[model samples]
Target: MVEPFRVVDLADWTRGESEPGGAEEKRWFTAPDASSQSGRWLFKPRRIKELTLSRQRRARGDAPDLLVRGEDWAEKISYELARLVSVPAVETELATVVRRGTEEAVLGSMSRDMRPERWGWTPGAALLAEHDDDFDSELSRGHSLSAVLTVLAPMNGPVGTEFHSWPAFDVFAGYLVFDALVANTDRHAHNWGVLQNPTTGVVCLSPSFDHGSALASGNGDVFRADRVRSGAVQQWCSRGVTKRFDGGVAVGLVDIAMQALSLASADARRYRRDRIVGLNLDLCDDVINAAPNLSDHTRTFVQIAVATNRRRLIDALH
Candidate 1:
């Protein structure tokens, strides 16, 4: 079963003027470096007198601030599905905000700032630079999955002694499997990273985030309904391609997973495959069924699309 996420009715909060005290007084941080294509704002809720209550509402454990992005509900659904399958993902919530005096419900995903005063995180692109001198020039031409794997594989073995014992490689491989299952096409270099523990000197892969691009988020209800009614759901799955690698080349999401699996070590491969096998489609259906304000046509389309993609992923594993 998937864990329940806290849903905040921003409309009610705004109307009641009961939004967290001092929310208006708090300074919002700018995030120009964030890779999200949508607008993002950094928010920190004022600490409540009750400690337990404060922790519960906090985005991540002990982190006082969260990066809030304006997104479609796809990120919320993707985050829920990721949790259902036990994949590490950032926590998200559904919120309604008044924009220009017009109220609209929007999906807001909050990520804890990994840089907590001392600890620092490194983006995949920066990590890749340590291995290849021509990283920037090559990226300007086209980024390929093969190139990424080639750089990351060394961390798993005798060559990169610094990360030989770390679980970064395995975690990254699992992320690729999750992305494949969700048809996420935006796993760009800046989207993933590794966090360093300032006190313990330990390093690990960061939990996955920025998934608004997945699940055909750009598709409208009309397009999805037409595809479902025409029985072209399979065609839609086949047409789903990743925006990363080879200059956003059009390649099937499953194919990307297969390639990533092939490049992974035996242990990494097993980890990814096990996670994929553990996916609960029934829970997925329940999630779709419980989605708030979803149209019947969209619900049906999402169900079919998820089922088709799940089958394709499982079949590829075999």
Candidate 2:
């Protein structure tokens, strides 16, 4: 049996916050790192504690900017993505549930004074406080196509000193593959990247982090609809092959992912064929079950999409 999830209490963070963990009290915070808000870590606390936790939630959204308030739900989502779908997403933990004796000032205290129109999340961070200055945003950071390619390349461990490029293209191919199986559509430019360790000559892709928005289509309001669509989805839903997502040509990671999905239909071969079947079977269950947020049309589209793209990928691979 699945263990009952515990609601995180705000008082766990500090004193003064009074709300219980029932209504608004059941919230997790994404503390803004000096880098990017997207880079923020998930902190599950109720009342008041660190000021860092307070600034994490914006006053305007009623909803969190990106971080989901309920840590329990978010953790499960991340786990399913990683374990079932094989996506290299974030490692989430149950930080702590502080049952503080204080009143509910944690909410009021952290409320921002910004205008509703002015409120927004910071997508990119110039630097991670613990890391070196070079990682920080400069005009140099967003300019080069090679620079974008470097994110997939292996770099130094943390400080990002060494330049050991990873089998970036392959890893990216893996991610695109896994994400497609799960019907995940949150692979925006901001969510994907590597946290380089300059010390070691290792450029590991940041574990495929942040997929809370993977199945959420309400995002059509905040972001571009196709921003997260798979190339296959784009092909079926939006007219034809899109260079924006598939890199235009029938190749690379997107192609590989689509083919993996198509393998579900084959009745021959032994090992590789079975692996594809398992992946497809798992993908169908996970996406259909966990995706309560998606519409019937959208979900069905994903189903057909995987098969269609699978065939596309197979043809390309052959």
Candidate 3:
């Protein structure tokens, strides 16, 4: 049996107000550990599969007490997967949030802030809006591949790190490949962006973040069990689509990933293709097996989905 992941309690950390954007509830907090190098972390609680009612409750100032899905585990797992595949991604940890002066703890995941000193994070939506005056960030109609590539063409890879030698679009292609492997359907215009320094005016692609929507996180155990038992897991994986990239374009996850690869340089195409083709299933199994509180059915479902998607992506690339 794999060992469980460590969960940090945020009761003692200095809590701040909630951060803006995204559908889930999130809050900013400063890590209290003096030994820790990271300064700020964003905590996102495991969201309920059904978010309409949760939104209503939040509007009414009530905390949701309904069934929370496995997004927290999905996030941590996605982080490990991205790291394994050499994708630039944010670091995430499983944690519990205990309100100040309260004993009850809320289960969630915390992502360390990746912004460098004197740099600000900007989402793709804002950049796209500026790139094209007619572009609407909230809608999927104008979030085209051509527009996104045009915005990233002139930028460099992530700053602060000398290891990244690729340009922004090349790295962005890797992000799409990672999304295809994990079936992350939430890579909307707002999900990705660039980091810019105000003083020197340097900009680069930001590491991939917000993967809670991946690996079938929103589905219930019954649905996963049924698909696994019925031997229809591949069917479900094939149906996975990223609606955020589709206005009426109607592209499958693998198709979109391949499209990005085609637009990328030969070096980037070879790099991402080699990574996908060389991905080890056993190591991926270790990631799935180690996720905290993941049911047997869910684990099996994720394994099959990833393996299926990997095959599909490889076939598409070939």
C-alpha lDDT of all candidate models, in order? 0.61, 0.37, 0.85
Model 2 CA deviation exceeding 4 Å by range: 1-11, 14-79, 93-151, 154-166, 198-202, 217-276, 280-318
Candidate 2 local distance difference test against the native: 0.37
User: Which residue ranges in model 3 land beyond 4 Å of their true spot?
Assistant: 35-37, 49-66, 100-103, 246-248
How do all models score by TM-score?
A: 0.70, 0.42, 0.91
Candidate 2 per-residue C-alpha lDDT over 1-318 given as tens digits, one digit per residue, 9 for 90 to 100: 234333223332323324242223443343333322222234433222222334445444344334222223333444454555334455453344333474423211121111122223222232221232443332223422233344434332111212123343344445555544433454444545555334543334455544333333223322323433543454542222212232223233444354433432232222222334455544554534453333444545445544554454344435
User: Against the hidden true structure, what lDDT does model 3 obtain?
Assistant: 0.85
Candidates by TM-score, descending order: 3, 1, 2
Best by lDDT: 3
Cα RMSD (angstroms) for every candidate in the order listed: 13.2, 13.6, 4.3
Model 1, residue 253: displacement in angstroms? Answer: 1.1
Show where candidate 1 strays beyond 4 Å. Answer: 1-6, 9-70, 99-107, 112-117, 137-142, 150-166, 200-202
Candidate 3's residue-wise lDDT over 1-318, tens digit each? Answer: 767777877877888779878876799888766636358889998866543456667899875454557788889999999988889888899989865467567788889887977689989988888888878766776788888899988898887554257778888988899999999988889899989888988788999999998988877677788999999999999998887874645578888898898888999899888999999999999989888787899999999999999999899888
What is candidate 1's local distance difference test score? 0.61
In angstroms, what RMSD does candidate 3 have relative to the true structure? Answer: 4.3
